[model samples]
Target: MNGGGSCSLGSVLCVITGASRGLGKSLAWELCSRVMPGSTLLLVARTEKALQVLAEELTLKYPGITATWVAADLGTGDGVRRTVQAAHEMNGQDTAQRVIIVNNAGSLGDINKYFVDFTDPQEVDKYFSFNVSSALCLTSSLLKVFQGRPGLQRLVVNVTSLAALQPFKSWTLYCAGKAAREMMFRVLAEEEKDLRVLSYSPGPLDNDMQEEVRTHTKDPDIRQQFLIMKESGKLIDCHVSARKMLDVIQADTYNSGDHVDFYD
Candidate 1:
């Protein structure tokens, strides 16, 4: 284990996407303490207030660490490009040796009720953009940046959900998008043998998403099942999941081309 607080300094840079709340926020905090204590963290989230709060907290708590916030919608081409550029700038335009990319931003939706639900097609588009496209785009851009740095341990961690493993009735679009995102990481892992890419499902969490599920489900029995799971403490918390992800990233035990589930 790396002992020094400045372990993240000198050569490491970690980029965390969707770092406003829940698992993303927890992961950002954990990473700040553990792997990259003094490294530069580029936090990407659409919520400016949340990002600002996190950045300020990290700055005050860890004096040596550098926490920068980019409040941008990462589900668009422009957003992805701007995020990559921001990371490059922070890394001094190709000077950083190790870049840890955490693609943790995602969304869930109910597309079963209406196939053409366009109350916010733009929002839905943003979902796909952040969930799938931005991950790929950012990873591709980083790979380009790390092309010549043979000894660098370039890592990309894709945060997925158990929903990708099983099909749910109302979460059709979410399942499809997550599945696509996982497959994209798998393929990228295969294509880039040197770069470490992991597709990880953090399982069900007691977060807003689950609360939404419990509240919105039309079937009482199904909702009860979820409630039972939650009451039984079977549902994982965002912090626990975030810690597990950090362990996986540090251990480098997962197969680059495989999907690792928290349930397993």
Candidate 2:
């Protein structure tokens, strides 16, 4: 530990969203393998069963790391509170000197019929709430806990997308949500000097979300774009993406508010 703490990495605490599957799940395993022995993981997701299974697997595989989880619907205020409370409980009065928050959970909501769903209020709300609002709420809540430590290093990784940067017709809502999330972190980075925020694009992956996006699009061009990637085997593996992400974030010169692509 850098701050005269007994635990190396200063009693690291990682709070990860969407921990049950996809990049989130891979990140949990990747972090456990990389971080110090005394690190603690707080996994968040909507499904309890999946989280429980992951917790057991991580605890068994990486006995040095402690794992806990809170299953909550991330699109709601209650979900944010529950996640914060779970992190506090896991902290157990002795907080970690180093905290990492990975905001990985997001939604693509009605990508196929972007125009048809344009009038749907609930769809729009869900897209923003889950993709942008949830991350903001969680980060704000945890900042209070991580601040004022003797040698605190607080880092936030906002899982971003190409949709955020490139304008894709059928993915209007998806693009907007990701873009908003990235900008939020960019602003946060400017305000919080001690907090390091990185908007990371993991590149395309062969995940459930990809499958959904491929099938939902009525637009031939949009559908074919995804189809070509799948057929061409261009999608990155979840575990490989996870490993590279950890490496990139741990780089000595990695700065706050960096818009990093996996290839970079």
Candidate 3:
């Protein structure tokens, strides 16, 4: 088992997507705090301002570690290419011991509309762009980089939701997107020999996304159910969940083709 603070200087490179806020941000911060001081972290987000702020904060707090912020929309192939370029640039010409890629960026479309009522093709496309295509493209690009590099532990954690297991009625498109992303990682894990790909459902959380679900839900019963879940301590804090994910990455406990659920 890899204990805490196992990495040495400049040995680990972690690329976290959707890192501007919520679980992504929490994960980045946790990693910055726990990992070796001089490790490199590549933060990807759509918001430049947030990413810059986070980069500055990490740099200020942990002066030894290098934090590079890449503002890219991972929903498209071009964005994935840019991310790959940034990762290679960060890695420089030296070979890294470990490359941890966290696919944490996702979107839950307008939850108020039912499957039949939500007929906007654009919205459906957007869902696929952010939730499924982004994860797939990013993983593929990174895996290509990891190939032929021996003695390097590559960890890909696909951040999914419990909805992928238990489908929600109003969130048909969102659930479908998550399910597709999860399956992509699963299949990739089966084919890939070097990298460890894990489809992880981080369970529910007391985060902005949950707040959005609560606010957008028109049904009182649904809202109340979420409220109860939130109040019952079932929802894990973002920081705690992020730390658990980091532990899993460092320990390398998962099989190549594993769907690990935080709740389970």
Tell me the tens digit of each residue's lDDT in model 1 across 13-103: 7888889998889887877776434478889988999999999998898776788988888777877888878877786645456778888
TM-scores for all predictions:
0.86, 0.93, 0.91
For candidate 3, lDDT tens digit of each residue in 83-156?
A: 99998788673445777888998888778877888777998888788788778878778777655476777788
Clashing pairs in model 1, backbone N/Cα/C closer than 3 A: 75-130
After superposing all C-alphas onto the true structure, candidate 1 shows an RMSD in angstroms of 3.3
Give the runs in model 2 whose Cα sits over 4 Å from its true position: 1-11, 93-97
Cα displacement (angstroms), candidate 3, residue 86, comes to: 1.7
The better candidate by lDDT, 2 or 3, is: 2
lDDT of 2 by residue, 52-105 (tens): 999999999878789999999989999999998998787763456678899998
Q: TM-score: which candidate is best?
A: 2
Q: Count the backbone clashes (under 3 Å) in each candidate.
A: 1, 0, 0
Per-residue error at 240 for model 1, in Å? 1.1
- Deviating ranges (above 4 Å) for candidate 3: 1-3, 6-10, 218-220
Residue 85 CA error for candidate 3 (Å)? Answer: 2.5
Candidate 1: Cα lDDT at 84: 75
Give the Cα error of residue 75 in candidate 3, in Å: 2.8
